[model samples]
Target: MALIECKDASFAYEGVSVLEGVDFSLNAGDYLCIVGENGSGKSTLVKGLLGLKKPESGQILYGDGLKSTEIGYLPQQTMVQRDFPASVYEVVLSGCLNSLGRRLRYGPAERERAESNLERLGIEDLRDKSYQALSGGQQQRVLLARALCATKKLLLLDEPVTGLDPIATGEMYNLIKLINLCDDITVIMVSHDLHEAVRYATHILHLGRRQLFFGTSAAYRESSLARRFLGRDRI
Candidate 1:
């Protein structure tokens, strides 16, 4: 069964349609990369999926089983996060806050999950380190570990590799690929790196000014529009 299903979804701001007639389905283990220009409504679509914004028309369904918070999200790190004075362990443990049962303390399961996520991401040694003291790649991994502490079912990433160096970018993509491909988790990510997306993603969701294209990576490579925008050899 599909994990997420969208039917004829459209989102508007002040009656100005940003996304129109969008439809897509995501299954477990599917990795879909979202591609578009600056004003192509990629974030808006993400917001809609996150339930932060309601679509003006149509429906969005999450398999009638997953909780809203179960959709793990790794947003682009901003300047605010870079300067935050929290330990990496503290930040990761925060992912367990929402799942707590009105308690004022961390349960054994929550702590174990956080620790496991950090260990899985190879940041167990940095658990006591300050968040701001880590390098850009380490910071990204910490945030991902935090997200993974919540759930491994559905993952959403928004421009997660923006300012990182090439090696960091490659490593981050490889981690995400492992989560989606090896762990059987579903991924819906917004990416500016067409080359990485083409190499890793099984499906591509392209958003234009007022249109959307949903297809497999090979199908996107065959389209003239995708070829023009994403480049011929790039895909």
Candidate 2:
């Protein structure tokens, strides 16, 4: 079964429609990239999928043992968030808070998971480091570890490489690709980098002002939408 399905989904803010009649499905181990122009409701669609916003019409279905709260999320960072006062371990361990319910302390299992994620990201050495003292790339890796502590089934990333230099951006993409392919985690990403999207994603969902395109990456490369917006350039 599909991990997540959107049937005729639509969203609005203050009654002004931002997305309408959107339909899609995400399967296990699929890397789905959502791309669009500004104001095309890419972020809104993600909010709807995450259940942070109620769709104006239609339904979002979750199957294959997936729950709304079990999905890991890596949001776009702000300057203030980049300078947050905390240790890397502290931030990552907090991701288990959702599973703790009313508990005040983390269990041994949660701690193990956090440490395992840190090691998986090859940032075990930075566990005790101050979050603000790390480079931009390291900071993003820490955040990814935090998100992994939340779930192993699925990850939602929004503009994860927004502020990094090209080298950092490439590293981040490689990390995410490894997580998706090796860890077998389904990835749903909101990205503006069309070139990288085509390179990394297995499937593409392109949202225009009033149009939608969904298909395999190879097929998307041949669509008029890709030709018009992305052009023939591979970069």
Candidate 3:
């Protein structure tokens, strides 16, 4: 079954329609990259998928027993978020907050899950370190591990490598791919790098305030849509 589907969905930004006619379905283990220009509503669509906003028209459906709260989301970081004063372990352990629902304390399972994800991301050694003291790449790794603690089924990342150096960017992409390929978690990412998006994603969803293309990466590369974007692409 589809993990999530959007049927002629339309979304608004502060009550003005910004994206419309979106239609696609992501199945289990699918890696979808949402690509668009700056004002094309990519972030708005992510919010809608996360249930942060309701669609202005049409539907956003979730299947396979997936709930919005069950999605592990790693949003674009702001300066304040980057400067957050917290220990790495404390930050990651908070990803289990959604699963805790009426609970007041972290159970053994939650702590174990946090520890496992830290090890999974190869950041166990940073457990007791201060979050703000880490490098940009290391902080992102910590955040990625935190997101993993939220769900085993889906991961939603928005421009995950925004400020990383070339090496760190490559490592981040490799880690995300490993999560999808090995852990079998479904991934939906909003990205500006069309080249990288097509290279790593199994599928692509191109938006320009409206649905432009939806298909496999190979098909997208062959389509005129890819040519148009690549022509203007700096890469």
Query: Could you estimate the TM-score for every candidate?
Result: 0.96, 0.97, 0.97
What TM-score would candidate 1 get against the native?
0.96
Residues 1-235 of candidate 1: C-alpha lDDT, one tens digit per residue: 6789889899999999988877999887889999988989899988988889999999888884876678788887878999899999999999887688689999999999999999988999999999999999999999989888777688888998889999999999999998887788888899977778878999999888545678888887888877887777765
Clashing residue pair totals per candidate (backbone < 3 A):
0, 0, 0
State the lDDT at 83 in candidate 3.
Answer: 79
How much is 174 displaced in model 3, in angstroms?
A: 0.5
Per-residue lDDT of 1-235 in model 2, one digit per residue for the tens? 8999999888889999889888989899999999998999998988888889999989999999898888899988978877789999999998887789888899999999999999999999999999999999999999999999998799999989988999999999999999999999999999999989999999999987443799889999998888888877753
Report the number of the highest-lDDT candidate.
3
Root-mean-square deviation (CA) per prediction: 1.3, 1.1, 1.6
Model 3 steric clash pairs: none
Winner on lDDT (1 vs 3): 3
Cα displacement (angstroms), candidate 3, residue 123, comes to 0.5
Task: Assess the local accuracy of residue 135 in candidate 3 as a C-alpha lDDT between 0 and 100.
Answer: 93
Ordered list by lDDT, greatest first: 3, 2, 1
Q: Candidate 2, clashing residue pairs?
A: none
Candidates' lDDT values, in order? 0.87, 0.91, 0.94
